[model samples]
Target: MDGSCDDVGGERTALEDVGVLLADQGLSDAFFLERGLVKYGDAEAGNLVVVQVDEDGREHELVTGAGEAWLELRDAAQAEGVLLEMVSAYRSVERQAEIVRGKFLRGLGVDEIFAVSAAPGFSEHHTGRAVDISTPGYGVLEEEFEESAAFGWLEENAGRYGFTMTYGKGNAYGYLYEPWHWVWG
Candidate 1:
């Protein structure tokens, strides 16, 4: 009852072939990345699951599995006086593309953008399993959120809900430390 998405193929081997993809539109539509498996397009056709995380009717969709766990985590945090809010949730390919474009227009080179942002099709947001969380008194998506009481609470308890902070101050992934970004297992 977790969730589902497109399944491409199950068997994978180091390919001796490497070639250029003129475009990845169809390729992406035919596959998806998941926590532990590769998904083919048909899996998402009728069973792709998402859920709204906000009461504002914005349809802030998140992968159903993560959405359910996030709700539980949020409630638990609230009970402890630590309120968590979703500032950014699932993003479509189009939206991710726009974000990268905007960053380029703002003078960020591709390398710099990739350091802080994922390049469209390569974004975690595409899977609907990643979220940018925030709380009261600090700006959404700001590093300052790291110093908030909410972050402290999450640091101590998020793993209980199958969540993990993706980028830490000096860890791996070659991306900027993103304390606000959490991905569900």
Candidate 2:
């Protein structure tokens, strides 16, 4: 998070805003570099489409290409008796900051939080291509998802739909092995 933060509509303004937010959260300007993290630009609002509406009425969205690919992947999995559910998709930088702030309020340090969550403007979710997924009978966002039939199906077939697991065991980014996270291009 060194130089600038980018949103579809604005770069300099978004950079300033994200910088202030990170400062408020006590993050250093070199946070991303220190963690070997990549900064992601926000998706264009017009390019996003609702991919799923959660039980709590929250809309999980992705950029059109990824959203369409996700739907196709889910349908293909269902046809094979593997159900995939969207846990999270296309998070905003603001929402990411709130998540980080919540972790801080809960007494977690930035190091602990970064192990599981990306710094606000650096999350892949901000790009509208990443998704957190789960299946029936598994806890959402849990590592146990790696043991599910859905995970097996994804490992075998998600690539055909242009999705790949982003965070794996011992990932270079230093995040925990997040078997539930994937990104579509």
Candidate 3:
């Protein structure tokens, strides 16, 4: 992901039609530049592998490298008596726009929406390397997950498996603290 102003949509296989994707949700090129956001190309659909199927039976997929790392990380955590589960992974640029649009329809302002959700093409989820994780006995995607043993375990051990928490208190990107969001390099 980089901050280049190169045409977001072209013959480039790595990038998406980000301009149209954002505009559909009422965002503009200025929004990205004003926030100093980095653009993340969505991973090729074929490059993803199913990592898990949640209680709701929705499949979670990640890029092959990330999928392998996630499995290893989960096993290691289980060995240490920590249960890790994936709540989200591998979102597309279209899905990101839908999320933003949904928030807007729910009465959130653009600033409010971006505080928790990245703009289309800016979310690491598009790269298939970022994940939202939770453990048993906690509400999914809630801030309370930060208080769980899983968060502590991840804080202490996730780096060994190549994952790092992306949004913390007062993060530079101005997003709310998301202790459960992590990305594998």
Candidate 4:
């Protein structure tokens, strides 16, 4: 299949194409590109964002929730000498749209941009379960998170917290590789 062309055999929408972009960026697992999978806010109200400090003393964020599992994960990280901080949590679809537009101005083409930029209803950020982690001094964590220690740590342990890398290795999705971003189901 051509990475730039739409998946004719699949029912994926343009929004999912954006998810492919995210996967290529390393924001999460590529599997997220699968069609019809619900993310963040479904009927469970379990979407949240959490922050953490890396060995470099830099702050980072991931999409998560304020549930007990999240707290437990935080506590575990703290016990291991990891400084976890809570950054922004639960973003609205409007916020996600703003991000999509900004990405376009940054030189992302229509296909490279999420379909949400054109239609807000398809945004993963709207689910509030997806987060744009903050890599202080690194601009948006989307592209550079891979080189950050905070993101690496999360990659190793986020699954234990019910959080997973929405775009990453072994994923067929084509988003760029982002070491800093993550999502909770």
The candidate that achieves the highest TM-score relative to the unseen native structure: 2
Off by over 4 Å in 3: 1-27, 43-46
Q: Give candidate 2 regions above 4 Å deviation.
A: 1-26, 43-46
Query: What does candidate 1 score on TM?
Result: 0.70
Candidate 1 vs candidate 4, lDDT winner? 1
lDDT of 4 by residue, 7-72 (tens): 322565434544554544555422343644444333333434445454676543333443455567
Candidate 4 weakest lDDT stretch, 10 residues: 114-123
Better of 1 and 3 by lDDT: 3
lDDT of 1: 0.65
Model 1 RMSD to the real structure? Answer: 10.7
Give the C-alpha lDDT of model 2.
0.82
Evaluate residue 14 in candidate 3 and report its C-alpha lDDT on the 0 to 100 scale.
Answer: 26
- In model 2, the worst 10-residue window by lDDT is 1-10
For candidate 1, which ten residues in a row score worst on lDDT? 13-22
The CA-based lDDT of model 3 is what?
0.81
Candidate 2: count of backbone clashes, pairs at least 3 residues apart or interchain: 0
Ranking by lDDT: 2, 3, 1, 4
Query: lDDT by residue for model 1 over 1-185, one digit each (tens)?
Result: 01111121123211100001102123232232322223322122222344544676666667778888988999999999999988877776556656655564455654576568664455666677777899989988778999999999999999999999977896454577888999887
The TM-scores, one per candidate, come to 0.70, 0.84, 0.82, 0.51
**Residue 130 miss distance in model 1 (angstroms):** 0.7
Poorly placed runs, candidate 4 (over 4 Å): 1-66, 85-88, 102-108, 115-119, 134-144
- lDDT for each residue of candidate 3 in 136-169, tens digit (9 for 90 to 100): 9998888999999999999999999999998888
C-alpha lDDT (0 to 100) for residue 105 of candidate 3: 48
Kindly list the per-residue Cα lDDT of model 2 for residues 20-129, writing each as its tens digit: 54676667648677767776656433488998997889999999999999999999999988999999999888788777756654567667988998877788899899
Q: Give the TM-score of candidate 4.
A: 0.51
